[model samples]
Target chain A: MSAPPTPPDPTSDAAMTRRSFLRGTAAFGGLTALAASLAPLRELSDFSSTEQFLQKYYKEMTPSDMAKVIARIEREVQHQYGVRPHVRDLKPMDGVEFVYCLNLTRCIGCRKCVHACVAENNQSRNPEIQYIRVLKMPHGSMDVEKGDHNYKDAQVPDKGFFYMPVQCQQCKNPPCVKVCPVNATWQEKDGITVIDYDWCIGCRYCEAACPYFARRFNFTKPEIPKDRLNPEMAYLGNRPRKMGVMEKCHFCIQRTRAGKYPACLEVCPVGARKFGNILDPESEVSHILREKRVFIQLKEEMGTSPRFYYYFDK
Target chain B: MDPRPTRPGNSKSSRTNLWLGGLTVGFLGLAGLFLAGTRSPRPARADIPPVDKKFLETTPWRQTYADLVKAKEDLSDYDCYGCHEKNKPPPIRFDDKGKIIIPKEHANIVMGHGSHDRNDLCYNCHNEQNLETLQVRDGRQVKFDNIPLLCGSCHGPTLRDWDAGAHGRTSGFWDRKLGEAQRLSCANCHNPHSPRIPPREPAPGPHTLHETTPPAQPGH
Candidate 1:
């Protein structure tokens, strides 16, 4: 639509001569080529695959590849939660492995550990969001691998009963990490497996894949009172999650990162918990494990390379 | 969201996956819990050693009998033979009605019966013949003061719960008035013959809680 201006009529001899001389050369192909290139406008519709088109978490994608994912995540959170939080790309701290152990022998049937985990994790108010279940075991039983969590209140023994608590095993070869199609759940360098909540599609593949019965599905929206919420938090582990994703005990990652023991470990009154790095043989847990027979959870089979160890003193 | 998350190419069958994923996993979880709650099955019941039935028979050797008889002697219908005796005194067995009773000197001795672990060997602390000068703590040489030390032997578990401010002989020391503090004998809180945890009080409804049925009035 933009046309080149025509030469104005010359009012004087000098202008006429200039215009006439200029028109003499323009009368050739020189002017038309400029108009054709500018007028050849075309629209291209991109039909790349959804994976290629969606730039997701930088953790899931390289920095150059994550733009679309980050933007979409921001938009989704804004639309659904009315607030957009920064979706962080966290790498596990180096030379550290977040390990957990439960002293099943000493655990009482008091559900203090479960409650402590809830307060520490800032888990959604839904009871299903619970990361721990203290299985009320009968007295003189050591096989926690065989322990199940079907206990109702009546199962709490009025006399002669012990308890065993179970949670995420946090395996080295986490089956959940293997099954995530988008690699949303990953094992950090520190041996903690975390989910990129932003990248999670709520596929629940993680729940199906985990062999330990650890992960849980958040089928409903999470609602929590503001005051009850643990203000101190982390993105990969304990941050309150939305509906339609799988969550489980994160080993109290927020607390562990700061060199504090898990809340569940601290609240256990019976001294039923021991936590340390397996790599460091000098660590108290490692020493206890070396001195006493420290059996990995579910030691019989299904070797997931779990770091959690438990044993009873005779 | 998993309208069709399962793919035909995924090597595991969805049926197997569904079973392994849920029902199998849930069943295993249930099986594990059951295992934890049950007694070990390997130990054969027949292997248990036979109990010496006579070890639990009654006698007159127990020193506490003096306290029961002397302190509450006027109280009629006390079942000394039932709670403290099982067989008869050493020389006696069946009475006129074919019932067991204490015989003369052996009438005061407790051979054993029912939770003897908590009640056995009463004379070890008590003076079997002497009922007057009771042995007690503070070297009181009275029968009562010795109870704190006597009961502390096996009852240390509960007594420890008390010392650590957990269990036993709870006092009203808090109110300092109505909740005043006092130490009572283990007998005051728990009847040695039959001890039971008090049932939680039910919601106040129409339940007379009378002794009409009266637990069949256990016999000596």
Candidate 2:
């Protein structure tokens, strides 16, 4: 049997005042407008997932954790770029100290190394990031202050100019590593200064501290074409970095640690670039240090003790 | 609808069969002719001549003395004694301007090595007694592969710098324990006839985001 007809609660309709309904509608309208105003944030590409947020610091992660992290990175890269990347976390070798020596005489101001580094490192293409900067210095002056970065000569090694390709010097006393508030960047045992991109807070202190102007900051999401993405990547080196992270040359840690020459050194047409372990006395860098004359650090007074040295052929 | 007893050969089905048989034979004959025509190989890629492939080359071609030796055994390509008299030394002739007249055979080579044509003489490096060997200024005989020693005789300081890793290009591994490191010879980079490094077109410069202002001058 149907129950006796229950009386409607007074608050259901009788208690709803016109003024109360108007107030409720105003509140709902305000919330909708606020949410609509936040639509631009949907375009921000650097939104972190739960997994990314909970990832451990580079030093704290164990071998198993690193493997999982690398797998995750590969999966993310594949999802974003439609290409599976070979990402690795290469450790620095024992009893090795890499040093770079640039022969000032041989460099013809050709910017091959600059573009090669960009291609090898998976650097951004649109807002165009490059690791190496080739300077055109005047013939008579040894001072770099007289150098020009934007010499648009049809042929290189212009009669009165010399080229100097500069990147991260991997200094013994790196100021970039020192200024990291989050301890995201540090110098390895092999003297290579590296950054943990995930751990960086993007304060850009390191960028300010870098004396050589080596550090590059990503103002927006890096736009890498699917075809141009380098399949080979390193966790601390050439791996694709996210927005708001700082990146710089790590001496091509991916290749050098695997007993291969840096991309910049390999692509230099004139062979102005020289890279080898300074620890090995028989290495080319050692020979250059022992015999070459007029070895000049970019800023000796800064006392960075850079691993990179430039010399003139007297 | 009209039922009638038809003759076997002139029947529509037999006529169609004949047409099908003729078509099959004609197709088979054409296919057999095509197969026979392609059976003999007429030089693979004969139409495509070897491209110079120098468009992308930033540096000059590698023509090292060692490479020359590896390319041809017994050095028949550079056999000076193959044409000249084995016992007699090749005669040296000079033009009116005191410039050594390189023979028509060696016209491919340009002689402008040193200033004032001081090193235009072929005998300066080539051994006069044995055409197969090279002689340094100190009268020590060297082989074709050992052109560095021959070059080092006059370029003593440059040789010392090269040995010490101050000159030329060194490639391969940085650590000897890890892998092999190769140091290029003098001829690998510089032409023996003309040691000067030629000018090259520079790679494209950086394209900055903001094109309004000039780029920051790099100080290095």
- At residue A215, what lDDT does model 1 achieve? 81
lDDT of 1: 0.51
Residues A165-217, model 1: lDDT tens digits: 66788887778888899877888777888776656777888888777678877
Q: Which ten residues in a row have the lowest lDDT in candidate 2 chain B?
A: B44-53
Q: Supply candidate 1's per-residue lDDT for B41.
A: 53
TM-score of each predicted structure versus truth: 0.45, 0.79
Clashes of each: 23, 0
Best candidate (score: lDDT): 2
Error of 1 at B99 (Å): 31
lDDT at B90 for candidate 1? 24
The 10 consecutive residues of candidate 1 chain A with the worst lDDT sum are: A40-49
Q: Give model 1's docking category.
A: incorrect
